[model samples]
Target: MINGISYYPEGRKYTYFLKSEEYKQILDRLEINYENIRLYFSHSISFESKNILEIYLRKCVLDDTLDLFNFFEPILQECFEPETNQYKFEQIVDLVIIEKASNI
Candidate 1:
């Protein structure tokens, strides 16, 4: 749960295709050209004005990339910490959560 709200992204079944563009702008902030992430709406409570930018890890990265974990480690670490992310807060998304899964 983030900010006292839990929109179960782990359940997966409840997440649907998000056609709204309100949150798209912030999405680019999550997926960078150098990271091993294929950004998608794994789960989001956009209807309630809460969005979680879910990114999956992969191998390949374009340009002079910092692998998957290396690049996002700082960002993820910041999220895990108690400090508030001013940049994320400014966007439509309240938090960016990461989960490692073998079975989808």
Candidate 2:
């Protein structure tokens, strides 16, 4: 298993989780033979409001090139705006892969 913390701009953070089935599917799609795979991630965004998250995402896209902006614009549009005092959180993404052994 792999575990680590991810730090984002404006001090935003999130925890991530990836299941074995998901990893298996990824490997299958890539035509890779893996003996095992695991992943984990952590971040801090528990105290952020939806607006803050939106702004953060926007900043990420805006500060970068068009490719980055296009990549995140859709996500920003799909994100729900939180209530006046509500908070929004995010999760992390981690991945690990173990290759199958070959016969000697």
Candidate 3:
């Protein structure tokens, strides 16, 4: 059985950026249709790397359930892969916590 909380759950301010060739290709499209990538997850998510990415998640996701490597997973464009019969995944961007001494 579990005893109690283990780690800090408070979410800190952060900045987000979208990467990948796919993301770059659709940048113009995203501007025209803002909801194409992240509709409700975060209205502020965009090409601007300096924007606060964790702002929206702060309200909903605390670090309570997190472990050494566990962290909030941001949403990205879903790409279907027929070859592997699975969805394609890749590193979209890097995130930096505003208050943290350094990002993990």
Candidate 4:
């Protein structure tokens, strides 16, 4: 849970859609509480290939909006370690989270 909020990308398939636009655009679409969504660079990525790294999110909840920064933060800090390739680029795919508004 991000910032004590149960938020995660709704489905793995939708994640492919989140990377289509700029980071801001994705956040806007998700309507995630940016104020609450913290950014971290401790995330991890495994170098499966010269330009590929596997990513993981521990317990993020699925909400209407999702921040790549959130998913990427942990990887940037404490996950991926071993890498042999010196040249590699990551192309992040888009991710979407479907959330329903609470009744007032």
- lDDT at residue 43 of model 1 (Cα atoms): 27
Instruction: List clash counts for every candidate, in order.
Output: 0, 6, 0, 27
Clashing pairs in 2: 13-43, 13-44, 14-43, 14-44, 15-92, 16-92
Q: In terms of TM-score, which candidate is strongest?
A: 2
User: 71 in model 4: Cα distance from truth in Å?
Assistant: 5.5
- What are the candidates' C-alpha RMSDs? 18.4, 10.7, 18.0, 13.6
Error of 2 at 51 (Å): 12
TM-score of 2: 0.28
lDDT (10s digit) by residue, model 2, range 22-57: 877877777776665333433223234545554655
Best-matching candidate per lDDT: 2
Which TM-score value belongs to model 3? 0.22
TM-score, model 4 to reference: 0.22
lDDT of 1 at 9: 36
User: Between prediction 1 and prediction 4, which has the larger TM-score?
Assistant: 4
Candidate 1 lDDT trough over 10 residues, lowest sum? 42-51
lDDT tens digits, residues 1-104, model 4?
A: 12222132343434443333466565566664233233334333445432333223332334335454455554344333446322222333334443453431
lDDT of each: 0.33, 0.43, 0.33, 0.38
- Residue pairs with backbone overlap in model 3: none
Candidate 4 C-alpha RMSD relative to the actual structure: 13.6
